[model samples]
Target: MIVRLGIAVRYDGDPLVDFTPMRFLDRFVYRNPKTSEKNARKGDKNVFRRKAYDPLGIKKLAVTSEVSALR
Candidate 1:
């Protein structure tokens, strides 16, 4: 997969600035090989996983943020 971060800035009395011309980075999505039909039937539907890398660590960050918000 590919990951990209776009930044846009606008200064007062100035033109809009866009940083979307930057190149995208490569990312990996992993799937559990052991997730079989039986597991799917048992409600183990989410077999895909994301890596915890710089710039965007969705897997770890999302879980922690959601848990904290529930408190």
Candidate 2:
């Protein structure tokens, strides 16, 4: 779970609030433009997919690798 903290405001002469908390999932879903003809025939025109990545894993690998001797 991802927690986002920020201030929310209304432009219609509303009182200021301290902060707002928003919750989100680790996985994200988005529509793909390249939809297959079979899917379109089945009434599923938009192709939805999830993008997965591990930033921590890449950072760890970079830190553990040996530095170049030319430096």
Candidate 3:
């Protein structure tokens, strides 16, 4: 019989993971030529830009989880 149990929780609050070099590489490799041409016609530069995670947003999410865990 176990009278007590221990659990461990770990949290990392970093948004840099969302901007990886591989994402840019993959985007260029997988982009459709037709789409690229259309975008170019519209004078859109810096194509294949990925949306990165917001630091404040991640912090809010972490705090919400921590609060629930305390309860």
Candidate 4:
């Protein structure tokens, strides 16, 4: 005779003994632009400027060529 058994599921806190590095690496290697900026206290916008541009680093580069998407 064959017997069937039910699968048991459980919830628990992170299994990793060291969660810090994993979290850091996840952000360092696989992070997205929006999230990275937010984490660094940088605001979001249409133009994305690199480091060295402070206060007014993001110059309006698309004003003369912005095409309306709704049009």
Determine the C-alpha RMSD for candidate 4 after optimal superposition of all C-alphas: 14.4
> What TM-score fits each model?
0.15, 0.17, 0.25, 0.22
Residues 27-67, model 2: lDDT tens digits:
22343456567776888545565545566643545544564
Q: Give the alpha-carbon lDDT of every model.
A: 0.49, 0.47, 0.66, 0.56
- On TM-score, the candidate that comes out on top is 3
- Model 4, 22-71: lDDT tens digits are 77798788866555656457555535566564444335344454552322
Residue 22 local lDDT, model 2: 21
- On residues 1-71, what C-alpha lDDT tens digit does candidate 1 reach at each position? 12354555545642333323221121123433565776668786555656446654443466558664775
Order candidates by TM-score, high to low.
3, 4, 2, 1
Q: Give candidates' CA RMSD values in order.
A: 21.1, 16.4, 23.5, 14.4
Q: How many angstroms is residue 58 displaced in model 1 relative to the true structure, after the best TM-score fit?
A: 53
Clashes of 3: 0
lDDT of 3 by residue, 1-71 (tens): 23365555454654476458886788889987665676768887767778676676445556568764675
Error of 1 at 52 (Å): 36
